[model samples]
Target chain A: MKQYQRSSILVIGGAEDKVHGKEILQSFWHCAGGTSAIIGIIPSASREPTIIGERYFNIFRDMGAKDIRVLDVRDRIHGEDKGYQEYVEECTGIFMTGGDQLRLCGLLADTPLMERIRQRVKLGEVTLAGTSAGAAVMGHHMIAGGSSGESPNRALVDMAMGLGIIPEVIVDQHFHNRNRMARLLSAISSHPERLGIGIDEDTCAVFHHHNEFIEVLGRGTVTIVDAQAMSYTNQGDVSAEAPLALHNLRLHILGHGDRYNIKNHQPIAAVVE
Target chain B: MKQYQRSSILVIGGAEDKVHGKEILQSFWHCAGGTSAIIGIIPSASREPTIIGERYFNIFRDMGAKDIRVLDVRDRIHGEDKGYQEYVEECTGIFMTGGDQLRLCGLLADTPLMERIRQRVKLGEVTLAGTSAGAAVMGHHMIAGGSSGESPNRALVDMAMGLGIIPEVIVDQHFHNRNRMARLLSAISSHPERLGIGIDEDTCAVFHHHNEFIEVLGRGTVTIVDAQAMSYTNQGDVSAEAPLALHNLRLHILGHGDRYNIKNHQPIAAVVE
Candidate 1:
């Protein structure tokens, strides 16, 4: 395991305004492996990243993190100065502003900006805070919601890959408002090998390194799906025009104050939250 | 495409206490898809399924369902019943009673009972309804969530694989009740080549055959995840002990009463609900 100076992620389902922004920032501050300089990566999609950056920048500023700096990944992805790399080197933490997770990931992907961010996180002492899409992109798979849940056969729905900072989880923004648990579970059940997480609007799941489980914050619930011994093929013998015939999957439920271990992928029975 | 006689599904998301069992049954009945007989599969897992079934069975009975048979997949998975295939063949719709989807699928999977059920669905006219886990297994992948948005570098946490019905859609139940959207999005986004659907409580998404768009029902919203263009890897160079790194992905929003067409494994735009 690569040691991180400060390792923590403040994952919020949505953060358009202040109602949960303060708490979200505090959570990141408390859990960031260690250190203080905060870097915010502003993305241009869905909405302006500057909006959420202001929220975090302000909170971080109050938290004694006066060296907060917002870097536009778009402007820095190819810049020769390695300004992003340099910024990450000196920063105690890095923040990914909320916008379209796809936008943020796209900008940082394969660029020195994301590479340096990864190096900083792996070295420890990088506090990661992302609201809405920012939060969604931290997962191995990111939720890109559209349309409704009429049937599992629609071709219009899909999940985009994200930053992979949190490889074990999949994320969706505005979870409760859009009613996404079903889709998440359905996605997990087919594989029945990956756990699915649903984070509610304005809520956060704080992961502290070496902790057996994560702590849930905010008013709404954080759902869990654990299928340990499941087997089935999603591809049935039916043709393209036929209805889907899926089989063989299971689910275990979890809520706030839950302790889940990644190695075992099973709940650790209750730990002091 | 293998022709189906009719298609319908009973979506039971809410508990009998929170949402009327009768209401769930009525929803199925109204979307009967011309089903005259509905079979309920019940297995012990939690207290809700049985309670719901007992209270709502009469309603379907009142609706003049020719036969409302309740059978245990365990008793019939391997048993040789001369009428087993005929029993399933005679039904216009086979309604799976809600309970532990795993236990139910476990017993019926790969058995003559499941084969019969599969054939019945293939015959089309068979409406399979699953509440909670029942809904969770409809998709090609199912979520067996056990809490791991924190550490994903390790092996998968959930078990997947269920009866093949819905090929691409990943289904999660009680979507809004529990925060599962993020997890589902992660599961599919990690793959970044599939779609995820979260079905809210007391709701259903009806799919019309021939690749037509899916229709929505109930008071809850349905969340969709699309990943037409996502670039990611194994979160390479990251360990199970730290926050993983991710790359690119996108997200789109959807709601209830809206229709989404799945073309090329991505969610296209649809009219708002």
Candidate 2:
């Protein structure tokens, strides 16, 4: 339970525009201090770990990161390798690719590599960026599984422990494109103490100043579900499989250039010229 | 966030045998210092708060409690009333009735009354007991709502803030009778950091000595879902609404006279004479 004091995180909704311009990836690179950065690509979440690792390696190299290495952690054994630990220790930026979130946790959670990554991020020496499943693992309360298009219902989503880089929030990737509102709403309704963030495709929510405010970037919207002020829900009285009824759920949809204040639970309007 | 250093709590599953033997209620009374105890019945969870309050009032009185008062917190305004605050402050024991957990939270959460109750409990001056919906609100990660019968799935259960008397454990009531194992499993899978306790009907899990160990009483069993050592879960790769696949989920069933150690995540065998 190492508390992150001054870490900067980029949680991208899945399907980031890698082909067109790779702007979200570029933003992550810039935040990592541009050409001076030593980047590490952790592709443990992907089934084809080496392939995805090379994918990110090339991307970061093409963006002028002189030193970029892919740490292919295929299992617990690889996660325990000292060489990978050294890579994590030396890297200024760590990028986690989109794939299976549980794969990421199963391989890296509680391992030495995970510890080093957390330590570096906590000391403000690293900028961690994750997309899709990578993004989902950023929060402690990760939305591991759930369906789209359905209204809020009991047992609509399944959860698993995440990497815990962000403790107070639950992250959902491929949000609007998959119609994940019902599931994310259900998630926050259950755990109102933690903020629910739904990041859409091609978008990224940059948590700056130790996660105080998140700046939204990319083509899609970031939906924030805050149930702190919620008044009522029929969760107990209703039968299993019944549609959920929640009241006073506060939602904020922010797109490119917009910002959201996590502490205040309000949206920050973009400054006008 | 006042943590309870040395508090005693009695979390009962629904349908306790109040008329036949009244063993569970008697246990709660005995733990509250017997005859000299002044118990405050918070019937905010019940729809007919006054009627349900009086029912418990008679029950406690018949159990030979000298002073029993019903704190009718109908709304947030009533929760702020000075008279109610005094009642909560002076009471030696507090009992929350079973009904709608959300109704209880909606009326009392963050109110002056809740603050006083929390303070009293934290100082080890009050014995907090709840049944059914009452039991659900004992933990910070309260299982606000979820469906039964279905296999573990995404968004199967809903959560909200609870009284925080038991911060580390998630309490589920009417465990076996309603078949709530699936939802509780789903809950622990998502938040492995917290322990999930599912209490069966007519049974009560008594957490004494500052929640070091839980003593089981009554007829049914208390199911403990410990996912701390879980090896894997299909939560990330499975589609929404698909049956959840989890491996290495440790479960313990405790009946009368059994004890469970929370810190060690193991059951202590009952001593034989």
Candidate 3:
């Protein structure tokens, strides 16, 4: 018999307006199982880990997460420290701060602490959430770096290995504000099998039920680029310095309260309430 | 006990100077066991399948292969045709043409014919080679499309499912001339576990001995991006419109007669002629 497991992920685009209303944070809190949740803030992605870690700590604390703590992992050596594994293992919710994604992956991707966190998430023990760089590292095919523009071109994006929390999708933060549509299109164009999620600033995409459905929240839009049916491209014939031209690419724009079905690649309209 | 099998792939960057000396094609022919080879050409990626297929058919024919056939797979349904499976099964070499990679994948991927090709490759029955768009689909992580540029940025490249002939690598064609360095770097940055090979026009990277070593052949250079030890990137913290900044990314450039060790991520210097 196939084993059933529950895993949840919260991917927030950069600059989520925390002071405005905290709707996104509230969604994350609820996904983490509310007041009884024990949250662990992984600030390894941040250059100033302590400062960034404290910010999330206070936010979660104010949101009624009574048992919230920060895990300050500085390097691969620190991530391997057995002392930190227990904290990650004990948490019902794990929140990763926004910073350099490569820093976070470098410090924790192969460590015991990260392994523990992954194991717990696999076993339905925790809800993992990240914002900006933190959110980018949630997927296996991470958008490590890239510039934003209106036109799709070759060599515009960089990809790196992520934590493998979400294996089938690639997440990009601060979508619309930065005009990342071109780059996102480029990413999906190159790897059509993997879904691309462009989370706008102040918005979040909550993936639940084993990542089958993603519920969008907050003030901004979440753009979905599905290149599975992409038909044409001059990628092979065109010169390197020229702009890219692709046809039959599909795009989906979802806003607050909207839900997306990953299995079917369909969008569900939000309830009017 | 583990199963031991033999498989090989020749990925050529686009615009290979087929007319100049046919050095890259010669390498592929040699790998396919020379005159004794029975080759199959899959022109599914081309909109003009017959034209492209016939082009390779003559090339392989002139190269002294007695048995050369084109597998005109029009769609997913045609790929399921039982008659065509025999051509792919009997061939000692299979060459996929350059056009729309998505077209090739759309028609052949997951179909019975594709499965047969994969089975044959795994069983050491055939040598597979592809150029340009053909080459991109050689790996599991396919570069579907992207524009050319000198710098890496977010969403600058797209990735899709390839034929899975090379499971641990991503192949890009027209490396230097197209200025695809940025996109390839982006790919490796996001998925460091997988190696990235950028084949310049007319160059080919031949994977043999169970993909333990890659032999570079052609006039142009092959760029290998190894991201396993990548240390840092400001991918997450920076604005979406900002260009990428990465540190400690390892790059290797190889020319004719140069070989790369996949396991060690090192380049073997070419022997002085």
Candidate 4:
């Protein structure tokens, strides 16, 4: 029930610019404390955690982060180590890379190390950024796997328990790039209480202000599927593969610099300063 | 909440023998009062309700039933007709033919006629038989549409509201012939409270004695998937297309003359007469 009052959670879609501009990652670094940032890279979701961790470590280090460590946890036991917990506790920024979300939850779900990270992130002590698989795990109801380029249906998207970092929303990364709108819509049909957020590749939905608002950053757009006021859905009675029919579902698209009010479920037109 | 204390609800899988043995239909005829039976054929689910309805009416008539009426209700307004309600109320036997479960529900869901039919069935006033689409709509959570021949996942089934004659179960007809075991499993994943019943072609599952017991009659087997004591399922968090993983799901297969306890969720092996 705790809200992110002072914390900044950057939920990035996959395939972020690691080479050139790094505008999205730069925002994360700035929010994470710039040169004074004590950063921790969590590549547990990746198949090759060492390579992924080192890659992120280099990204932050080259961007002027003085204190950085790669918390390459392959197994759940690694999350129990006191040393990792201490490091997570002292970190000003945490970065989670893309890979298998089930593996991510399997290794870090209930570990004390994850708890410490969540606590620091929640207490406004650290800024947390999760891309792809990491972004997928932000919601309480996570989407582990699904297909794209299909009409929304009960069988189009698969879901599982999420990390609950931002419990109110279901986040899907690489949205437009993978043609995943229908997938997200299907996921929302099952759980209408949760807001559906589809962040495009290279894009980021920056949640701030107690998680009440979202600011779109980087290239591409963010699609929001809100079924809070859904009038009807055939999800409960049909078989999984049947095409789902949902009525009165609200949708919003936010491009770069666009702002949204999560509480009100409304889009705010971009302001030119 | 009304238990079927004395009702005989014949849930038939599609392609029940119309020409040769006609065993399933015979059981329905015998249960309906035989020579004294006043049968009403409801072919509202069929694309050509008149053709389907008349076909069933003729079948029942040829089987020695003295009185038979084809209530070919194609529109929802037809369900509001007092004539239809009166006929439904007077009929000692009701037969629902196969086609589209959604169409059937769309026309009859909350109609006075359907209410009357449901009330009569619940009160043990009528012996009702539904085949294929008819069988599918007998449950509270109906498998309106879905695919077969695949692994069980959230996306394999499409469900909708049914007539709910037997509220505790979900029925899928044409089971083994279409390889729909995965489809039924997917449906059960969404609703663990409902008992899943997959009836094979040419088969009938006859419910009797306060809906507490099910007797499998005819040629094929009835597959039952019980998730009441299911220990673990990734259904809650996975995507729709992702293959589902379920643990501790109880399964039972019953052939001709096999009896099963619906209340206890157990199979009573076929008794040697």
Best by DockQ: 1
Interface DockQ per candidate? 0.04, 0.01, 0.01, 0.02
lDDT of 3 by residue, A185-204 (tens): 56765677899898877788
Specify the CAPRI tier of model 1: incorrect
lDDT of each: 0.54, 0.77, 0.75, 0.81
Once superposed on the true structure, which residue ranges of model 2 sit more than 4 Å away at CA? A1-6, A237-240, B1-273
- What interface-residue Cα RMSD does candidate 2 give after superposition? 17.7
TM-score of each: 0.49, 0.50, 0.50, 0.51
DockQ of candidate 3 is: 0.01
Tens digit of per-residue lDDT, candidate 2, span B1-273: 012222678899978887978888887776666787789999999999889899888888988886899988887898889888877777888999999898888888889888888888878898888999899988888888987534356677887888787889999988755656667866776677798898877888888777888887787667677777655555675565654444444555564666788888667644434
Candidate 2 residues A215-242, lDDT tens each?
8777766767777765555556555454
For model 2, the DockQ equals: 0.01
What's model 3's overall lDDT? 0.75
Maximum-TM-score candidate: 4
C-alpha lDDT of residue B221 in model 2: 65
Q: How should the candidates be ordered by lDDT, best one leading?
A: 4, 2, 3, 1
> What is residue B189's positional error in candidate 1, in angstroms?
30
Interface RMSD of 1: 13.2
